[model samples]
Target: MIMIRVILIMLFGRCLSCAICSTFHGWIKKWIQIS
Candidate 1:
C-alpha cells in the first residue's frame, strides 16, 4: 500500500511538471510572436 501510494505520487508529480512545462512553452511562443 505504501509503495502504491508512492508510485501514484510520482506519477502525479510528473504529470503536473509536464503540464507546467507545456504552459511555459506556450507562453514563450506567445512572447516571441509579440516581439
Candidate 2:
C-alpha cells in the first residue's frame, strides 16, 4: 500500500510539472507571436 501511494505521488508530481512546463511554453509562444 505504501509503495502504491509513493508511485501515485511520483506520477502526480510528474504530471504537474509537465502541465507547468506546457503553460510556460504557451506563454512564451504568445509573447513571441505578439512581438
Candidate 3:
C-alpha cells in the first residue's frame, strides 16, 4: 500500500510538471508571435 501511494505521488508530480512545461512553451510561442 505504501509503495502504491508513492508511485501515485510520483506520477502525479510528473504530470504536473509536464503541464507546467507545456504551458510555459505555449506562453513563449505566444510571446514570440506577438513580438
Off by over 4 Å in 3: 1-17
CA lDDT, every prediction? 0.71, 0.71, 0.71
Clashing residue pairs in candidate 2, if any?
A: none
Count backbone overlaps in model 2: 0
Candidate 2's displacement at residue 24, Å, is: 0.2
What's model 1's TM-score?
0.51
**TM-score for each of the candidates:** 0.51, 0.51, 0.51
Q: What is the lDDT of residue 6 in candidate 2?
A: 82
Candidate 2, residue 29: the lDDT equals 83
lDDT of 2 by residue, 1-35 (tens): 99967865776567756776567557768999999
Candidate 2 stretches with Cα past 4 Å from truth are 1-17
Give RMSD to native, each candidate. Answer: 10.9, 11.2, 11.1
Model 1, 1-35: lDDT tens digits are 99967865776567756876567557768999999
